[model samples]
Target: MTIPYGYAKGTVISAPSLKPTRRDHETQYHLHFSVQVADEVWDVAVNVGTNDSDDLLKYKLVFDYRHPLIQTLQASPAGKNDLTDVNALPALDFVRSDLLGTTGRWRDSAVMDGSDTPEPVASLTRLIEKALSEKFDVYVFGRFYSEGNGIHDAHMNQGSKGRYIHRPNSDQNDHNAVWQDGAVLIDCRQPEWAAYFAAFEQQYLPTDDLGNPTPSSSPIS
Candidate 1:
């Protein structure tokens, strides 16, 4: 039972902004950007970091990511689209698709609330600015909001373990699904594409068909 997943493609119309919030002793950092598809403006919220110092998240921004799915995504309709079939659609799957790279090329990036802009947010701002100036198409893949105003979950969505796994009544692990992963892909300058992928440090690789980590799975180094 996978959660509702989809992608939104549109043109950047507003400057990207970052907000850090603290609620119930937990910190969350979100990068926000606006996009106009047809006549509607949709909000794209990207998670940059968290307060988990021990298991810091792993992030990667490929400036020149090349994949066959880029062409398919570009041909899709603009605005928010809800993908029902995970196997048929062009959803992202870090472990299954190997979008980052076959080899071990992952990095660690953590953002905190501060007066100065962090590298992660700053880099995203630059890309959004460039897209605004060049009129490049911004493609966001994640879970669509129930209110139909925006989309989020712009990160990995599988391989949950320990407390992250779903309990009997909790929906925390509802996002764990194969081919329903989240990512941000940009059609920058013809023939060039930028891709952003993120995941928690404790998420294991070699997930099962259902996107759950197997007994022999291991965390990315």
Candidate 2:
């Protein structure tokens, strides 16, 4: 769990949208991108939410409009992702698990703001910023900030033990540069792509061989 599930392509140089944050105990929706890979320019972020809103319980967004990062973004060439590291895609905990093929859309963060709250994380942050304004293709994990690098634990890793951001503990404060957070979002455009994932009512569906989340303290349901 050293955070590193790569797959890149660039654009949106410094972010200007994607909001809906709470910070201190979670409720995310971050943004930031500067990807470029093969010529270096890494610095990404695309966090979705869950943590505040009472740990955002009662969920179900296992989407996958044809996952596999959308068949690798309809077979490459939009922002970039010809498989560049993270052991060649598929398994950085495979985007919130159940191995793609998801479909349970019914979300309910206890009526986040009532009024028939159908925000669905602001409708998937407007389809992940309409697939980041274009030239899409991005399925990152976390860590590796060679000066503000991005791609955070988008969501769910399992049985959090307290670290701060959605899950991470071990005395945090960068507990030797955190790891095993969670995330599984993809934003493509060719014929469609979107798999924004989220998980936190404090995770833990068994993990350990480096996938972290093997401990717990209960009370987060």
Candidate 3:
């Protein structure tokens, strides 16, 4: 995918790293990039893949700011004195886990709910805007996993367990109408960023066969 924002040129300053996961059978590979946009410093992670052959590809973009929730909590009276020291402040475990995969079930729950507030989609957009205004460097990470096969019944005695089951593929041309699913973050930190996003919506976002914004594929379950 083409990067829409054109603030400053970015460069890859670090090599990729491979790390072992807590799971005995799983491993992960991570790529890092240090970007210099104007005088600002930003870091990005790309192409994060897992050792699990069946895992799908995923991506994340992060910024260098305190988590909104933690910041809010720290301002409250009960947490005010307790978190006086920045180092002693309670870490926003939820945000950290979203960016760096963690074993806690919270991430899974967020994904399943679909309507969860403070969705990553909005967070990403906010980050872009903030970055543009402060000229802070922004980082983006992408990951991919092996697509899973179709669902099956629970039959303990079945000998076909190892066989590959075929599932329908997602239509590339379909654009989900839902805001969380359809919207892409546009670095609207600058006027150009807004224009870029507008152009993308007018040109590439999928439309119905009749040339409308409606999608023609099955809705995500």
Predicted model with the maximum lDDT: 1
Which tens-of-lDDT digit does each residue in 1-221 have in candidate 1?
44778888899888878877673456767788888976898888887876766555677887878877877887888876777466754877776665666324677765465432665666777887898889999898888776767888888887877554533345563546778778888999677898888787778888887677889998865
**For candidate 3, lDDT tens digit of each residue in 16-79?**
2222233344453323334453344444332233445443223333222223333333233310
In model 3, which residue pairs have backbone atoms overlapping below 3 Å? Answer: 45-141, 55-145, 55-146, 56-144, 56-145, 57-143, 57-144, 57-145, 58-143, 58-144
Q: Which portions of model 1 show Cα errors greater than 4 Å?
A: 21-25, 102-104, 162-173
lDDT (0-100) at residue 141 of candidate 2? Answer: 49
Best by TM-score: 1
Weakest 10 consecutive residues of candidate 2 by summed lDDT: 170-179
Between which residue pairs do clashes occur in model 1?
none
Which tens-of-lDDT digit does each residue in 74-170 have in candidate 2? 4655433322224334433533444434555435554343222244555555555555567455555444443444445445444455453333433
Model 1 TM-score, all chains together:
0.87
Q: In model 3, state the lDDT of residue 178.
A: 13
Once fitted onto the true fold, the runs of candidate 3 whose alpha carbons sit more than 4 angstroms away are 1-9, 19-27, 56-221
Badly placed stretches (over 4 Å) of model 2 are: 1-4, 10-117, 125-139, 142-154, 160-180, 184-197, 202-216, 219-221
TM-score of each prediction = 0.87, 0.29, 0.23
lDDT of each: 0.76, 0.46, 0.25
